[model samples]
Target chain A: MGKRLEGDGRGGVEQDLLRHDCSIGEILKQRGVSRRDFLRFCSAMTAAMALPASFAPRVAQALDQVKRPTLVWLEMQSCTGDTEALLRSANPTVAEIVLEILSVDYHETIMAAAGHQAEGALDKAIADFKGNYICVIEGSISTKDGGIYGTTGGKTHLERARQVCGGALATIAVGTCAAYGGIAAASPNPTGAVGVMEAVPGTTVINLPGCPVNADNLTATIVHYLVFGKIPALDSHGRPLFAYGKRIHDNCERRPHFDAGQYVEQWGDDGHRKGFCLYKMGCKGPATFHNCPSQRYNEKTSWPIAAGHPCAGCSEPHFWDTMSPMYKRLPNVPGFGIEQTADKIGLGLVVGAGAAFAVHGALNALRRDKEPNEDTREG
Target chain B: MSNQPKFKRYIWELPVRWCHWVNMACIVILSVSGFFIGNPVSFGSSASDFTMGWIRFIHFTAAYLFAVSVMSRVIWSFIGNKYSSWREFFPLMTDAGRKKTVRMLRYYLLIDKEVPETVGHNPLATAAYVVLFGIYSVMILTGFALYAQHAPQGSMHKALGFMYVLFSDQGMRLAHHISMWFIFGFVINHIYSAWLMDIKEHGGEISSMFSGYKFTVKKEE
Candidate 1:
């Protein structure tokens, strides 16, 4: 099926661009992106993918030969934070180049079409690229009351998600909302929001799940697909294993402080000023998984923990429910209310047991003292 | 009935007793260190304190000891006497055993005054032991699964990677954390039950765990 997108060998760079059927490399060349810059991006992507340095050239070669794939981006029940983060990618110029090569046929938030025109564009894109376009969902699907909670273009978000994901080559859930319902599905989820995969079963959905997913990860995922003609290797959560494989704590800049038993006891404390570990400040880095450390946001400028804040484990599944309160360890034990921690519950049980033991022991001692020969009786 | 005097009978073997105490120590260390590892308490300000690191090291060490002791105990269950045998731990396998378990439960509830005498663990205790072992198996399985995430990709990964199918890392962590509490409750109940039985039976049940022998009145089979 991918062969249909291949270009004819008899074409010059200009001809390839005119036909809109050239490899990414030819398109880059046409766009005046030098070969060196393209290769440098490929090398960077290779490193991000955790491939050996020796594979950089191979990555460049693969990327240079791939056709511009069609993409349809759908916005659902979300704040559009992922789109904002994507715009703020480390290399916006490179991001634009990559987005151009992908030929995003229809994107609701960024497209110029309005009302019926936009709906027509979506229908046309789905028809033209049927079974070939990549479906990028940026938000969760609201399935409550037949998806009345979120509607766009006269169709509910759940209906649109199922429709778009149905005929796409691959479905990419681009943020925590689209991946695992994020804040939209947190406790008291009256809207009944669900992730893309849950909204559309029987399809492989690649989850790039950050609160606002790291642009580098989204770029790498698309690049991996463009280069390899398949989804990148995913973890159990359907996230790219290379990006989410290691714990954030393992690579945090303040790891030395963690190992040294130094921590910021309170906000803006001396330890905090000195960049001690944020473990005491309710950092979820120990449990979170992401490449935010090495692949810092905003062009490697800084991330949450790097900026003297603790990680909220935004990249993990169920962050809203599991990693909340932002300043505490352990999820609140259910049925015990928010004030009770696992430690508190456990200690309470231990204490209760001790109390019961004392009372039971005292009762047993009194019984034994009353009847010294009672123990000698047998049936 | 003209009764015979009580006599001491060898029951628990030396290896079984060793496994019990070592496993107990390991569990205590594992629980304390595991809690610390889960929720680290900041100690010093030096960048090279290594307190959490040492805590983790100790936790891992204790975890290994706990797993090994349990493994060795399982192996010994087969070779040990009837009292220490694997079958004794699974009293539900026999109808008679099931009946005794009910009777033991009734005795504990004060519905029955006369308790059925058993040389080793009462059927109720045996069933509880069986469940405890099941919990141990789950803890070990999940513990190794998490450990294997960091292990090199050869034999260790090949052996434990399949565990990924059972639980997500977060789910596994939850299970591991919850299992620790189950064990903690079991230890409390176990000690209390042993003391209660020792007093009621006057057979030195608690002391037998250490001495490998129980002083019981000789009765006709």
Candidate 2:
């Protein structure tokens, strides 16, 4: 790895100091964090990554000796919810410490620099860590109208993404917006926002798509990268397999209830109070892929389904269109009226066919009876 | 009509009739079970009841049978008699087939008082079967895609996960669900047409599916 420090001073000597030379272990030691706590964090990450417990030591060793890599966080057309989720991670102290060890050279939200200085820092970081830094994109890149929909520092998100993500070692699209355009690219998308992979084509983008991505998944991804020196295995959608290999329905706590056909029909019902399955209430868990059931949100407290609200399939692509009406089991058939569902349209066609056939049969009977002497010849 | 000698012609083979009834039974079971899977009937107040599980089991079992029947029928289309040949499905490929199809269309539209008879399926019915097969293909693919979710990391998951690239999970379910109605529509028309032809043509059209033979006038050589 290139360890050269470009000491062009926009900041002090402290900012110029080469922190990449320091291993994660040394930094954690300096921060008064116990070795046991560090190992526990590593084991937690290993477990989160669905690795065998025997691999904990390997993960711990790799993370301990690994040098801090440069990370550049790009916030485009987003709500900054991913960043908030990361800050409120399950193991906040350990996660924050691990994040701190990584040289996050450019982040718009949390960076101390402003205006031109911030822009300069971003450019400098990209230049210094070209082909090495991990670029984490948080929001969708608006591509319509020459990308005038979203611009920062006189540069369109598309332009900035192409430049920054094009050179990174690997790009992690952190939220649904950056992964699959989320709500911003919902129906009637005026901005024409697209995911980071679509915006910066051919770049190795590992998507961690959630409404606000689970901080644990992001943390596990970073740990996996640090430990393995490469990104984890990804699904077809480019999501890490460990975090998104199974449907939420498969691992859900209320799965037993679903199999037992005990569903909460409505809000505040007897079944709801008894912790029945939310399948009837239009839970999208069957369609959604996420570890939210196992790895709960907001510091492992409670996820949407666990809290009696059905999953809105926030992790899925085009979920705003495909996974709605959020309160219904199936999406309404497109090209049909908004209220007309697939079942309604299907039932109508079946009934119409039945009725038409009935009428035709009736007509054939009447014609045959009226013309009893009609020739039954094969022409 | 009284002087004509009626010849018993073998139109449907044993395998053809077997696959037809098998396919029919599977479609009916799959449709009913599949519909229930999509919109489960909430029953049994106790959590011990395995209603959805039983429903899903029936759906999956019917799905496998449907798959096998479809596959075998497709295979038979290659090796079976010319009547059940794969070429028969593509009726628009031949000039006579096109003419027959037009005649059948005219008869259905009441523009023509009579339609030319054939040994095997009429060109119009063959065309409809082709579309139904297309719907069957969509249903099977979408059904397998949905089933793949149950076995993540299994071979089925690996083989069928590409469906997500074509459609979202719920979209796949919708395709499978809507195709059920297409089958229902086809069944309605198919039954009525068969019944009508049996009555008007003096051929055992509906019974031919059961006996694999139809009564036709002998063409004197």
Candidate 3:
């Protein structure tokens, strides 16, 4: 496998170690993660999925007993941000154990294989698992000029995605890039990047869209698939409803301040110090739908809003275009230069109409005065 | 003046007038509150004051009324008199209607001194109302789509969630915001046109909306 993956001896050893036959319980036992800790993680996942506390044991049972499912991670035109988010999770042991539970047959970034070996692994994984494997895509697929922009192992991303994702039982688009093309498909998008669903149409794509998607949601999605044998319910955007069903504003910690009309007028103001609502600072919480307020990030430490910064609406579709002017309340009207907002355009049109009507009315009045003889007495 | 007697004809039904007035009030409240919701005014000093809460309450209440008014108006278009018929909204659909619309356009453009006479809404005003109704439909859809976000599991959410297929949340908000100005533009032109028609036609044009009657010249019977 190209002289084995160099660095951190663990990668080489992990690659050699195969756990295709092991159940998640066996993996947890081997990892020395206690039953209590595993159960706690299960409960947390159940809660995250909005399942009742009673379902925690059922979730634990399902996850513990389920054999490792084959997962093929395709990283295309990506920064590897999602992988980083998962690897740097707050509770590394639990994350590690979960990863161990899944037979990750092919992952370009972390796999020890290289060149032909990596390509071989991907093909073999697809053949072995066929329709049984889960495909997790990490970035947008470049389709410009037939995806010449992004290639791995001599195949275009579009070709790779269509081949791999087309056969998976269900595909999980793991980040905003893979889900909605994110920044890669922003305005003046030169690469013609599109999400996995667009690149590989008709595939069952469950979009988990965030800048670098919170790893807990990914873990929960995997766990839910393990327990339910099907993808969780999806919203209109094909996002898992548990995570993307509610606006950040509805569940925001600073909602009290918003209702009160208290706001952070500017950066580092007294109101800002007082933990006022960031809505006035152009927080996109009101429009964006994600479970960040409840789920938080980095092990429920703090999300952007909790840290006193506004939500940038990173999880939304085409967020780069739709939720920009990051410090403004409304998105800028796109066509007539950059700075004009909808309100400005709307107000301008209204005023223009009013002015036009005024001029028309005055003209009508002057004409009426000149035509007094034509007005006549109708009696 | 030609020797033709004038008679009062009942042009607008009660439901038509009610829907018109209700829609007008809702538009005003929805515009004011919707603007505030987008760019809220910071006034309350304490969390308990609930200033934005009250504003949102008013906005939602008006939105409900507006939706109901629009729905009832659509229903009334089927049941109301020929003057308020659904056919009036599509003036260009018929040859006579197209001719009247052209004549109205000619008068408005000062190509003709005579205003086109009609028992109900003139073809031009009917066409304008059709456009206004289109805007109203968009406003309702976008408005409820935004509202549906608050209760994701509610029936309203299920019903309106498809709007995301048409517009992103922020895009929907932008559309909803811009449409308010279109309505405002329509209102300005509408008022001016009504006033101009009232003065020029001397047919109780402004009073007809309130009284449901318009003075029409009696044709030989």
Candidate 4:
């Protein structure tokens, strides 16, 4: 807040100057990307957002005119797997193109600047852009004992997050850790880690939760913001509805096999080799919501199901806790411990109740036979 | 035949009987289909039939019927007659009703041999029915909430989509499954108690649900 760059006020003039000064069209042209390819990528973005074909040109025009928004990516209690996934762009596709559109101010893993220079770059970007820059938070914020678990440039990740996110437009919480505490906040969370929304109260946190969030979703989310000047419409979980709207079971490639009642009971049977439904073997696809089926990872190469492995429900909240044991169906009903399923517990109760009922019925019959005046009661 | 000493009293109305039977059928179908849906067991490799699809269809269809019958029962409780009215569902509304509940509990426990006299359900039965209705609401809400995930946005499915917000979809599924077991327990106990009461009281209690009439012994004052 030191140097308030003509931010909230003079919005129209700032937009015009920013667009005119450093246009994405010029940047892409310098990078040898043609207009037709750019337009095609815009259409792809529109399709990814579940928007109609007519909105493609609008997306293209908005993207072509907008300046590269400054982004400050902060990693807290993370594995840096999200950044690794982003860097592992399988092919020269739309995701890579979108990634290049953002002018990353400070990223711990990728940036050359470090020490005071890295902190200086973050401060400069926040001060210069004010309420216009984007804050991309990866991993969970360790709030235990004043966030001593994670630090950078002599400042705790929590302090740096609050400082940078104070004047940002919106924060994109990338990966499961940043969204819902992922594996870091699983049962007996040692560091008291929490998602960005919990760490930064007022910031509009758009969660793109996954073990290492699908690169396509990350690209689409950023493009949606660059085009519309706001984050895409989110579900109750703060995830973009287009990507996480439908359950993995609903849009599964193995759904036909599931409908036909063909399931792979074990890991290497003929059914498993034939790519049958993995529901029986504890595939959490039915309970999980993600676009991994349509939006396959690694440049449209092969998703988990196509690779003959069951989905782990990585994109969901508390997946580590709820969808554990990875290869089976049904969640562990908390008090039942990790080994027991709800069916097992329910069956036990039902059997016990049935046995008790039979005993009670026999006792009633004996009591009835013992009574001499039973006939008098009935007319 | 004309000098019969028995007296017959009409207890359940037609609407109440219809709702009861419809709900009973739906519960049977829903529970069977629901069990299969959760844990799909192989029924041979029948190439022609879509086993899981048909199972889910039957499950959803029965679920809708169950919801409708439950809703109808709620409406009927307000208008159906004194015997089938909402007041009968809450027997603890009066002081005498509370005493009747204790007496019925004692009767079931074998502490009292004399069955509590009631035209419809005893106070204990009324209380159990009320609790069962609460379980019905949970199943219906969670069922629709799960259905809402596949439904088009802004529809009635979306309107009841708050279950996902309150708990994860699996949590909703857990509630639905647990409630099914509760209904199963209720059904077993209900049948056992009805038969036991009929034999002990000699009031034609079990037949009352089907025929809407119970024969009671006439007493000379």
Candidate 5:
């Protein structure tokens, strides 16, 4: 599969898909993915895909029959944490089930080769998969310093991104950095960093923005593309609508506490022990937009806020800059800035006093300003 | 005086009267629209965009009108009659009125068996109106502050963002909600006192607001 596409990886990309779909029965039988396990995964993928339970069989047929789409996985300026987390996928490890079960033409981290051999393999993989393959980009693109700050195989990250996007069916920016420019693009962004969609103009990029987005989101996105030939519904940020549509505050388990005005007033207070709202403590969940509290991390084990810490809102764009204090409310509204409740109490007293004084003045004015015979009777 | 009819006209010029009633209508419209905007309901399906945009537009328009109307009333306060002008509130400006105010309050509470024929705005009555205006002024500022949120880069936006940053959008949101209660409280006291004044002191006190006539004692002792 590697040497045959020697020059054009597009052919190799097609063949990879062909083999994944054509030999799945034989291969699953051989690899022991098991017919029942494969069907279960299909139904689960369908559910994840947001289709009815009845679509499970169709999903099974599609999963078992769809050719493995060619995928080009690139790492730019990142910790490569997405790849590391990908290894933790609970179901069949999409990396293994799809990435391996198919003829993955190019994947830097998992590939056996390195240096000239690996570089040569990447080129072959691209040419073989052109126009039909999927491009999964991890890490942000550094546009600063002539994109020299981050490079892959002598090509700037931005350049490689453009090159791969030109002949791709879909581009998936796999983590916060690659999706929404993550922390790298936070205020005073030193790197002039950008997400894949920003780096490659006009390319339809789907973002999976979390420090490490839930792996199922990644696999589900792929399965969606494979089965439907189109990306799923997305929100304003081009993240899947199902995942990024609601405020973490809205869906948080702590929300009842918030609505009830019960809050964790101090770090070690009894309220904190009782798992009250973190809003007063500067939780940015109310302002942030994400599905963290809903989908959760590590298969619903626990999310950051659930662990009794305020949400850092890592998935939101420039969150570190905009939603700081991470737990406090947005700074005072503009004109209302100089005073809070103090203004209320202070002004109330002032006006209340002033009203008292004016009432007295009115009485004097009533006498002095009155006509000569008007008020003598009252006196 | 004519034998058949001679109408009394002591205070409240036509424009002042006009501004007062107009201010009332505009406030009602603003409060109604503003309330809906504050708690918008996107009646559309889950996929549809929110629909409170029209409600907000109406609210903002009403706020702008309310501001103009309020400014007109403030100018009127300065130049209108003894009953309606700044003089009306002048009694609240000194400490000497403490006993008078208590007496006036007692009169208002129906504590005294005999009612005073308060010809002009009474001490307590004048004070309450001033407080109402003060509350309205703060509500106006808050109204503008809330308006500014939708256009953070526009003038209103910058203004609103300024307040949101200063107090926090949540605080502003809260101020906006809580002030409604103050208005409600003011209304409760205002109507009750007005009704009481009409009942005890003068049968035509409130009607004088519309008819611009108040009857003084025919012949004081």
Candidate 6:
């Protein structure tokens, strides 16, 4: 278990990372990515980074120069959805080989080591790498009931995270659970779940806040870090500015449909199959931010909106509690009048209630004797 | 015995009336503009965008007017009619005013079918108006908060920073949208109260708000 350098984390994950020891040009020879395709990808990444065309050369040089970054992917209290989303992606296998050697130090599902051996190997990588590795954390940070919600080797996840992220170059929070406490921390989160930023405030936390973030977003963000020697400029939410800089409504594929007032009002309607905008279906795209519309999930196969499911806005914090009734436009305002939401209801209640109060106040105002006006009183 | 007529006099000054009417105009514009912004129905409408650019133009113009009105109101609080003064805006904080408020509520509830009259504003209406102004001030605070977002790191931003925190960016939006409905509610209640009071008193109390006169009967002694 003294597998310090070439990790035993991903079971045979180091093999996947090492399998592509050949240069990208050579790898492309096998995968069939042409010179044009590679350049196009480089240019897209540069633009996504918000750099001018001139930066394309630098991006090309950096990508060509750096070997894929060494990665220590950690899975905490989460379903393996993030892993599934990445590995089970459509045919183009670029995502599978993003890391030159996926030195997965302690991925529970994929790692080959058992119990003490896996735990021992994890410590070895931390000691060996010191400060030269990317730590990608998936899922939420559970701290409930003394961190008993999810434990690895008798150590709470909070304990494991602090150990892994102690001196990492940069930390990538891979999913909503890791980025903003997805459903696990929805409401009355018993696990004391939190995103990495809340978990480690001092570290440079690059949040890819999605239920399952776009694989390309994670790749570009990592590659941008590799090429530029720093994380990309981030928005207030600590999300990479390149991906979360614009609202989904600002560039949605269904944007034209929203502008045209073409909405699929009900399920099983013609508009639904015809693929109208999901705004009316409670698409959180207007309020929520992410790069799904542009990035296109599953190697450009489709996304939630494209596949006819309204986005639940898993990226936004407390989304389940905040943006629930996922198919409604207005979130229920707390301490507000209830009979006041649907159109005409608030108006009716207002008129009726106002009239009743008015009649009563007027009757009291009547049958009164004239008294000294306060304004007219002698000083 | 001798008989003579006495002047009832004006409780509100010219500037006060001007501020009030101007505020009314601004609120009307603000409500219409804000509503169009809220529900921008563009089906079968002429220009293709559901954003209602024209209404937004009017809305912002009214916002400027509203800003002026607020500035004037702040000044009026310091220097205006005694009845309109900051102290007079609230009922006496004395124990008597507290008792009067309870009495007024009970009176309205017909717990005692007797009417109580006092000078200026009754305790109940005075307290309600104070709350009314408080909400208006909040609307102003939130409106400026939205304006600051276009450029968020300067004097204007810092000046209104408290509002940004009071209602964060999202809350600012919710307040702005819902404030219009609050104004609509105020308008409905305001009109009914004024008309009903006018008919009950037979003093043309509602028209007097516009004509600035009230005829009062004086008995000779």
Question: DockQ of every model listed?
Answer: 0.34, 0.49, 0.47, 0.35, 0.06, 0.21
Q: What does candidate 4's lDDT look like per residue over B197-216, in tens digits?
A: 78765667888889998776
lDDT of 1 by residue, B123-188 (tens): 788788889999999999988777765532446656887776676555566678878888888899
* Residue range A1-379, candidate 5, lDDT tens digits: 3321222244233444456455444555555566776776676566555578898887666666666666778888888889877766554433355444345567777665566776766676677767777888999999998888788888999889988887887889988899867788877888999899888989878888888877767877887876777888885568886676667877889876654546676798977888876766878776556777866776556788899998877776656555554545533323445334433543465556556555644543343121213352231
- The Cα RMSD in angstroms, rounded to one decimal, for candidate 5 relative to the true structure is 12.6
Candidate that would win on lDDT: 3
Q: Rank the candidates by DockQ, best first.
A: 2, 3, 4, 1, 6, 5
Ordered from best to worst TM-score, the candidate numbers read 2, 3, 4, 1, 6, 5
Report the CA-based lDDT of candidate 3 relative to the real structure: 0.84
Please write out the lDDT profile of model 3 over residues A62-82, one tens digit for every residue: 988898888889998889999
Per-model chain B TM-scores are 0.93, 0.94, 0.95, 0.91, 0.81, 0.80
Report the lDDT of model 5 for residue B65. 80
Task: Give Cα distance to truth, residue B108, candidate 3, Å.
Answer: 1.8
Q: Judged by lDDT relative to the true structure, which candidate is superior, 2 or 4?
A: 2
Per-model TM-score versus the true fold: 0.87, 0.93, 0.92, 0.91, 0.59, 0.79
- For candidate 4, give the lDDT of residue A24: 78
The parts of candidate 3 lying over 4 Å away from their true place are: A1-18, A368-379, B1-6, B115-117, B217-221
In model 6, how well does chain A match by TM-score?
0.84
Model 4 CA lDDT for position B184: 85
Instruction: Specify the CAPRI tier of model 4.
Output: acceptable
Q: Is the docking of candidate 2 incorrect, acceptable, medium or high quality?
A: acceptable
Evaluated against the true structure, the overall lDDT of model 1 is 0.78
Order of the predicted models by lDDT, top scorer first: 3, 2, 4, 1, 6, 5
Clashes of 3: 0
- lDDT (tens digit, per residue) of candidate 2 on A147-183: 9999999999999999999999999999999999988
lDDT of 2 by residue, B1-221 (tens): 22355788887888899999999999888878777777777775687889899999998898898899889999999999888999998889999778778877877766666545666887888889999999999999999888888777689888886787888888887888888888888998898888877776666888999999888775422
Candidate 4 regions exceeding 4 Å error are: A1-20, A34-37, A93-96, A368-379, B1-4, B43-49, B218-221
Docking class of 3: acceptable
**Chain B of candidate 5 vs. true chain B, TM:** 0.81
Candidate 1 regions with alpha-carbon error over 4 angstroms: A1-19, A368-379, B1-4, B90-117, B149-175, B178-182, B199-202, B219-221
Question: What TM-score, to 2 decimals, does candidate 6 have?
Answer: 0.79
